[model samples]
Target chain A: MENENLIEVNHLTKVFASRGVMSKGQIKAVDDVSFSMPQEKPTILTLAGESGSGKTTIARLILGFIKPTSGKILYQGRDIWKMTKDEWVRYRKEVQAVFQDPYGAFNPLHKVDRVLTIPIRKFKLANSEEEATDLISEALGVVGLKTDEVLGKYPHQLSGGQRQRIMLARAFLLKPKLIVADEPVSMIDASLRASILNVMLDLKSKFSISFLYITHDLSTARYVSDNIIVMYLGSIMEMGPVDKVLVKPLHPYVKLLIDSVPVPDPERRWKNRIELPRIEITSQSLQTRGCKFYPRCSQRMEKCSKERPDLANVEEDRWVACHLYQ
Target chain B: MPDTLLDVRNLIAYYMTPTAPVRAVDNVSFNVTEKEILGIAGESGCGKSTLAYSILRLLKPPGYIRGGEVLFKGSDLLKIEEEELRRIRWKHISYIPQSSMNALNPVMRIEEQIGDAIINHEKISKGELRKRIEDLLVSVGLSPSVAHMYPHELSGGMRQRVVIAMAMALDPELIIADEPTTALDVVVQRGILQLLRDIRSKLKASVIMITHDMAAQAQIVDRLAIMYAGKIVEIGDANDLFNDPLHPYSRALISAIPSISEKKKLKGVPGFPPDLRSPPPGCRFYPRCPHRIPGKCNVDEPRLIEVKNDRLVACHLYR
Candidate 1:
């Protein structure tokens, strides 16, 4: 039997039309982005990029919160866009999201228990109130949250780390096959970030649930993700295994990003000044017939300004979008 | 400490509510020498920002400096009058506050806001002011054209750069940047950090970089101070501290940071940072510390004393 794809996003493009009269052009947020998650085993694929690099747009697209301008999202080898009402419900149940801000994600007026109980009730994971309580407690245990500490308390009563764990516990209640996390640990305290990541890794192993982890922090991404996609201005600069790409990058943009990250180790401080564009990267679409990173690429060629290089496979399991690599 | 530009001694700033006083910055002491960058590292609620606010004398109602002194260039800043402080502010000492989005006024243009800060301190002709504002913008890697744009018209990173430019507008002897690049991306963050380094070297000004990100501190900061529950747990040279953290909390904080180049089992400090309202006695980090001694760490609070050459730690293990 052929291997099935759990989630496949093919040539996705999302463009936001300029709403204000001052802005004349549309913003191409996600331009021709494509990737897939395998069905056989649990995998964590990270979409790493800077702000306005379309990481969040891809996450919103995968969650079905917004419609893509063009392309198809395949869930379990079936077209998600063409799914029926019943099928859509199943798809929604299977794929869930965990947002970055834990404080804003929850309702202040409601008790923390409400967040967990409603998902269990909506999915019909438990039959009665008693079963729901047991399910909630079990899910809470998985994310390292004690039942009593979080069950009846308000969001203000608990810390940010606790609130984030509660969100994870709620996701666990749904038993999602794919969890789309968009910078989940960015807002959380650094000391608490690792534990939450450990919880995600624990869930990945125990339940075999895949994760589409999206973040700008490369360290955490490399720590948790198996495969990585380096994005820049709504396009993939490089895509490969996490270890290979991060440890030794091929593309100039990826190399710049890696070098830019200030590692905790002071022994290897950044020595050379990174060449950057004189102007900040605007939200406007790059409509040039050339490489998008040509303005800032330190090793830009004459061909780079004239032609856009497609993401081509350069080595085994590694793809880079640069004329030099080709 | 004779060459120190900003010297904070046992500073105790607190938030007084109807019920009780929250000691946001309790007995915190450090110094920024001339032409030095002192990086204050800590988690949220650790009172890093409170310390900065207290030194700058910008504490609002319900939040006031309770005790301790801030000595800058042989004079006590905390004891100065409001009028004296107003003259000193942005001229001798300036601030780049956290969240540049809210720092810049929505109604004012970039140049006008910078001009307001400049005109308050010194007397200059209108053309000279415009030229100075443009020069400041250009020095911070921003184009002169950006001066005409409003705060909302610029991006988050651009707003942060503008904030940096405004802080350096008066050639202040000292600059306090509180989480300068917290919300910016890594690529943009690097550029901002570089700009700060350039500003420090070119102007020969002291900087107090207060942030929770140790990774960002390692890049440019000369000295590092780790805080927990409003207390400086450890203080030393940046390279020395990152290589060998004496306090258990500091050690846990350094290790908890996930590395991109290296993968290891990150042992996060378990438990939340102590609440300032009703803090536990003894050491603030005792509850979460891995090397906690039951009687010693839970009963008596450790003082930040010199353990090695130019290194100080507030843990019983060193004592």
Candidate 2:
């Protein structure tokens, strides 16, 4: 049978040995996380979490930038790590990534046009110079960037929004099946975020390209993604359809994450103040056998510290990892 | 008014470059009432931070105050001597610079950092200072044991609380926090914003919060000022500004923010902000404004005029 999934992550885990002077234990950066993106339908899957939650580690693992400690990342039924050299090139082409800082992605010495041109030449997408020029203009036009305005400019010469759009244009040139966007708009201005997000929506509908959108901003994630996975301390806290999970969060961690987002409306200010626990930055804190969020969870139980709850399906189209559900 | 704590009048701060003076804070005017959180909201490089630096007289080389009067408690901070200004800095007006969580000395313990701020202004005994440091840390929602740890030992949220503790070490009547919650996580950001609210209510100290996050401004600020191209385009009550913004730019800015509560199509302001060195002849926002008049908005610059009850806007449409 043909695999209907575009990518499948099976029990992904990554451990980083502490090299700092203050801490001296292994840190489970990503702990047995698993998810899949469908190949038939294009969907935007958002990996939502705070820093140190291992959302970026999963993104890097899928991109083949790092090796997982004990897990497998299967792209179209083939194990990525076990793939041949030809398969690796095809995997790299099919999976593209757009990082947070657009300025850092480009070399300052080269013109911005080189970013789009190099991708097409490397992927062998075009034959003649004329075809390459046409491909470059087409990609830029898709992302709403004009050729004359951005072609000859250096990275600093273009505004932040323009440079980010150029990055999107470069990603579009590959015609990839999946794009992993890590905090694409967090570095740009608030007023310009909507336009970039709109371009993402356009690409999804017009080009049928899926996105692995990783962000801590739930507001933008809600605006775009069809599904979301809430991670905390390298473990999956909640996973479901975006509206179902965000509207009525199941896990305590997901609920706290949603509540903490400041609403733009002034009439509905936060009613209650939450006092955070004193976060300890030691390796000992990371070695908890039970729930990692037990220290800060408001709905902690006696059993929570003794046993860790697995991500179990508690409702239709929703999975939550909490002792309350289990 | 008698309650006006900070009165900034036509403040013009520029960066002196080789080509021309970059008008960072251009002809800006506003008033911060006592015991109210005044928010200055704008995108990056719109000169909100420069305005804060100008108020504190903290501008460095290449940054000159061409003309302005920062009248705090009926005295112009601009005309004050350096020695006199130093005296008023921590004891009367304190500042939490942008990314101040990283501003702490890495080697020093948390208590010593708080102690340094206290000892600089007042001569206190070591025993008394230690007691004060613990109290400050507890007030910002940190444990007393955090005082013994270095800056690196603390998380980003804890370090931010430590910075808040230091700012409150002197109990200044006014605190200006520039993007205090910018780099923090959402949960930590909410905690920091709540701490700021607690500071305003418990201490009755006025706050001037400068940030680009409109949602954070809505959560904390009582009065809001929307900045664009180094000018105050609109200033009004936070409720009124969110409900019904007067200026087009303010409306665009308020609408630009994406919210989970409402499912609305997000619209970004089209064009980039004009260069400060040579801004447009008429309005700086005329290029991207959807309601720009053909010949009028591009010809005459509009001054900030009171449009409604306590609502001021600088737009030809308002006129």
Candidate 3:
């Protein structure tokens, strides 16, 4: 059931309960969510949402960092939660990650070479010392780093772009099938941000790798993604081909997210769209009403506040969860 | 003369480091007409921050204004003594850094910080300073009660407003902001940018915003200068630069922006900006410029000259 899809996630839910006396109720980081990674065709899919959207929880869960309370995750058709030790090793090689902060991932004491060396050794890709150095150099070269300048330099010594590239080079050296990049370029300078983004885009061509580019910036997601999935409060609001979804987004949540983004154009002022509610909608797990976005939705009504809307197909290759669209 | 509010000519500023001399702003020349917002857009290490620090005469060592003149109104900022520069700082050219959290002091209340800047330059007494601080806070759209709160108590947006209010404290002729809204979220960023815009019209003070976010620059800046390595490769009106980018670097940057609904693939310029200390001759962007031909760009240095009406570009193609 799992191997048919590259990664098949069905009803993935994570709920944490506090231990001991003066106990706390369960906190659901991720609610029942179902998604599948298509076979063979690897496109950059964006998991976009603001803080507390449970996007990060989903990433952690998929990476085997946390166990889901209910539901299952199938990587290359194997249930990841129940994978054997040997399977987990193979799984890691298939899914490599580049975290948000490039510097935080590496020890400051070690040089940039150490960052690349760890991955090669972990995967056991290199045969000998000379082969290891060659592979490191090759990875560095792909990311546009010079061995003479940055090889011996510490994380602090390299620029933000270089450090991120070194991290990326480390990931690419694994020759992973899918790369889970969590806000990979947000912390760096705006100019260097694009460089990291390009590395992900080019990797698809150079290494035949697919990227799960996670970010809050829709503009960046639009730039690098082949498909887009808009998430809201622990569940996906919409998912489809990037062209089909973004240009004509059916979900109210997706519409609001797109509207909020400051379009780079200065000529025409954006329409005075409905403002997002300042309140944090945290009472999420008790089972949602009509729509998760009902409280914040501009077109929300009495029906929206009462019924839990199901994800419906509004168009070809697009799924939206909105009452108005229905 | 348009009452040249902040006039800079041939400014040479460099970071005084143990490493090779960083010619951050090498013979860079520009001027901000009174009440106009001039933005300097460039990547990190391009010296946009160094330029802002130089104009304020606020270079904390490791960074020193190497040579050239920074004439704000009639006064030569470089020629001014430390005592004179201090008097001129908040009064003539105020500064707002990337993050307001660090710019403000933790121990003191908000009112005191605003009052301190007022007292440092003006002859106003404590009673008069309190009234002025209240007015300044109100002008920047912050509640007057905020003056009672410490820096940490307020949100990022509120603290930024406090910083803006501080920058506009003395009603300075020029406000140099280095990535003022980069730390904020989209909605918060819009609010901060609106506040800056509101102040720009009311105070009629020139704003020199140094940022790498071209989107922010397009939305706010009247004119823009694109820097590569440590040189301004292109400079023109924001609209013109975006629509008709003359330099290859500027073109690549404009195209680099991800369109929300568009499907076109973003073509990132193949290589990185050259090392400042030992930049190649001819065109500084020659290494990455796709149009680079052998003898033309590799042989001689290209100077920034007028390419079209009110637009300047530095490239052998333009020459």
**Residue pairs with clashing backbones, model 3:** A2-A77, A3-A77, A289-A307, A290-A307, B16-B62, B282-B300
List ranges where model 2 is wrong by over 4 Å: A279-281
**Which sections of candidate 3 miss by over 4 Å?**
A1-3, A10-34, A67-72, A76-79, A107-111, A126-163, A187-199, A205-208, A232-235, A269-316, A321-323, B106-154, B293-300
Better of 1 and 2 by lDDT: 2
* Global lDDT of each candidate: 0.89, 0.92, 0.80
Relative to the true structure, candidate 2 reaches a TM of: 0.98
Candidate with maximal lDDT: 2
Candidate 3 Cα deviation (angstroms), residue A21: 19
* lDDT per residue as tens, model 2, A1-326: 47658999999999999887755678899999999999988999999999999999999999999999999999988999999999999989889999999899999999998998888889899999999999999999999988998999899998889999999999899998899999999999988999999999999999999999999999999999999999998999999999888899989889999999999988989999898766564557553778888877889998888799999999888899999998
Residues A148-264 of candidate 3 have per-residue lDDT tens digits of 878888887677777888888888888888888898888776546667787787888777788888888888887888887778778789999877777778887787777667667
C-alpha DockQ of every model: 0.76, 0.83, 0.29
True contacts kept of 1: 0.77
Better of 2 and 3 by lDDT: 2
For model 1, residues A1-326, the per-residue Cα lDDT tens digits are: 25769999999999998888776777889999888999999999999998878999999998888999999889988888899999999999889899998989778999888898778878899888898889988999999988887888999999989999998888888888999999899988889999999998998999998999999999999899999999988999999999999999999989988988988888888788854344555655453678999878889999999999999999989999999988
lDDT of 1 by residue, B1-319 (tens): 5387878999999999878899899998888899998899999999999998899899997899989999989789999898998888899999998896577889999999999999988999999999999998888778899899998878788888888989999999999999998988787899888987887788999888989998999988999999999999999999999998989998889989999989999876788987798888899998888898999889998999999999999999997
